[model samples]
Target: MRRGLMAWDPQEVPASALADRLARLRAELAREGVDVFVAYTNIARGGSVWWLTGFTPYWNEGLLYAPAQGEMVFATALSKRVAEWISSVMPAGEVTTTPRPSAFIGEHIARDGAKRIGILELDDFPAGHAQAILQAAPGVELVDVTEAFARARNDSDAVERLLLTKADALAQAACGAVDVSSAHARDFIAPAESVARLGGAEECFTLVAGDLRSSRAFVRTDSMGSLGETFAARVSLAYKGAWTRHVRSFAKDAGVQQSMDRAHAALMDFSLQSGETLAQAVARTFGSLGEVNNWVAEQPRGSYPLAPVANMAESAQGFTASAPFVLDVELVTDGRRWVGARMIGL
Candidate 1:
């Protein structure tokens, strides 16, 4: 049903901030010879839309079409019922609602006289929708510009950092709410949900595992599982345009705790050391711990936002001192000592 307890501050990102973000994107598009930039979003990728427009679509899917020089138009599949809310944040005249969203978007593209267009998430965009845009703008050159936008979104602004700090605190609260004594996996869900909602989280994704024998992967607690002397909980919460995740575990054995201690040290050292890209740190760490599983050891340290879930195995080349990131360590050794997990933002 409904579970977010924390209400978002009614205050929205200032108009000037949004304008500056858009202006930066438009400038990037111009450098790429891209006439129009299309940003697509669904519930999962809602942060991308909010990054530029400061409005997160509640129920329906939407996108924004920003030309090199002109007003940005927001189009959605939702009707006027929710359209009003979108207009409140953006330009009312630029908001469009239609059952045939492709045709509506295509018509706008044609009107803008955009030929060299770049569509974010072009590979994932619906085939029917792509066809409609192709039909509207005959011989249009649509490029996949997701990487360009991702680059811009990599670093957080001052406003984003503030929001992320709040989100991180909310995640910590959610993790603290879990009661390992409860035994039942489902028992933790209600408390976690309550904490997140109270923290004004727009979304809460909670997973729990009571299995203690081996390191249990976090799973949605649709059905209860036994605690078996150990348990693990992972909670991810989204507030505003930022997300924070916390992972906690309880172990009855000292060996498991020791393993976790070692992993934590390595993770902290790797995360804090400056100058190494995520990929380099992973390789160096794996090389040092030759006996450890590279798959498990090298993962859990990667980029934040733009890809909220860390691609542990993937090597990230660029390293920025001020950019924010989430560092996690989930370790299992020789199938004997298993520590659940832990996450922190840096």
Candidate 2:
């Protein structure tokens, strides 16, 4: 029997569902007497920009304009295509693609008859943006909503449950490749040539293999080709993400196998003692409200006892299994071997 990190997509949250969520968020802004909520993204916000429009713009800026009295509108410095996509989420907002985002925003605020303004950033925004907004709407109540916006944006999106499902699968494939390489024969062509081969197909795996050939089994490297070694990974302990998809094909090390045997026995003992299977533990973790962003942002912040599955609902045209579950979990034998659960599902 097999079970592991499953990848999946939740479902398309309708525009109305997104609107309802935005209404709830906007209502919170209104309660705080926030006249508007402004946010920008050169890349990704921790969560802010995506909350307003179902789209998190890359290489652009996004804004959420809410009047205490009228419908909230989203603003951005993206093309009409981008605006149209966001319009599906917020039918009332406008989009622009000018060079000076601050100036464009200032002009829009003034033109739209805004009186009180709540900018998303007071510290982060350039002084010029503040000056422009003030020049455009001088008499208006100009306050900052950066903190409020930050807190509001932290809430998870229901649609993200679907994206994470796909993310988990990608993470699994990476993990699978890692496992395959790790347990494969440690073939060191040499330092003279090892550096050159680091960026090809097996860069991530070979870089470490070369260092292990030269240094102690767990020594670290600064750079081996394009694979810049960041830190030392503990030899026996597989990191959460690293072990999520591929089971180490067992390197046949006596010590490693012995330790594995002990761990397996311990796991079986625990399972019988607790009256639950490993699958039950995973299910509990899955239900932990950590269903967003590859489940990387697990709420209440506790690592799942196993390597957290990266994605669990994304597959092919339907529910086809695409990743393995590498349980760093344990199973103990009567006295011979160790055991851990796995997902060999397609």
Candidate 3:
């Protein structure tokens, strides 16, 4: 089980270096018998949309059409100059602009009207937008190719791996910052004690945020200043693109260390028992009710999910962090030495 978890690469990711993901997607599309990879409208924080088209959306929606068999193209609500700039990098066959992504998609679907069209990031699609795509071709089969895109897009491509490496290097440099800065000045580099040392964030000004999928955990600490209180967290592991980041924020208190010790132990224990790959653990915990306890919660309600923390170590380190010990807060995929816990200052 654990054999496969460490096999995955824990590559870092940058906002840039998302371009080559298309080639990988094209290959997956061919394997899966997809005709056209339709990337409609929104290019949220994920960076896949811009990778597909080289143009990021400011506010409106757009479309990306990548034929598994032929040239790639994109349509968006942008000026010709911006579109040309995007096309210059990716070498698209066509770059069409429209006020809305679904409208552009409807137009293109009307042109090809193929039997099956692949759609990525449909979660971002509004109900109104989905109807427009249906109207494009009544007989057309709209397949939910989001996972296919995720697999292809998230697979270790050359360029993306490079970006991941760059991100990792930046983090590594940050990790060493403690050596350069004095103890008093360590806050500029990172907090010396607390969770900063334990599988922590690298930057001094690190932040954590999540949306509908993970906003609860983020909001608990960020929105409500409540810490050290019990809280409940809901995380869906089945998600591929959902993201959450962590900052090693610990209030000045003794309990922080105690909570950190227990959290670390729990992380180790769960990893050992799972006897699964990163993929397997993900398949199991995703959409499942995995409980987290032992540490103080950032929320007055519950603890943050640990699926990310366990998954990342299992995904990157291969060994369990707190195997055969305690079970608390299963990380969905971000790390917090004490990121999830706010010390109940005594």
Could you say which candidate leads in TM-score? Answer: 1
For model 2, what is the alpha-carbon lDDT of residue 187?
25
TM-score, cand. 3: 0.51
Model 2 score (lDDT): 0.39
| Model 3: lDDT of residue 113 | 52
Q: Give the alpha carbon lDDT tens digit for every residue of 1-346 in model 2.
A: 0012221112444556556656765776777777665555433231344444444344456555555545555555677566555454333345555555666667767777766677666566557667866776667667666555534534344544443333334333342333222322232112312232221111122223222222323223444321111111221111111111221112235655454444433322322114443344444433232221121101200111122333333211111122223333322222222223233321
lDDT of 1: 0.63
Rank order by lDDT, top first?
1, 3, 2
- Residue 236 of model 2 has an lDDT of 16
Deviation from native of the Cα of residue 168 in model 3, angstroms:
4.2
lDDT of predicted model 3: 0.40
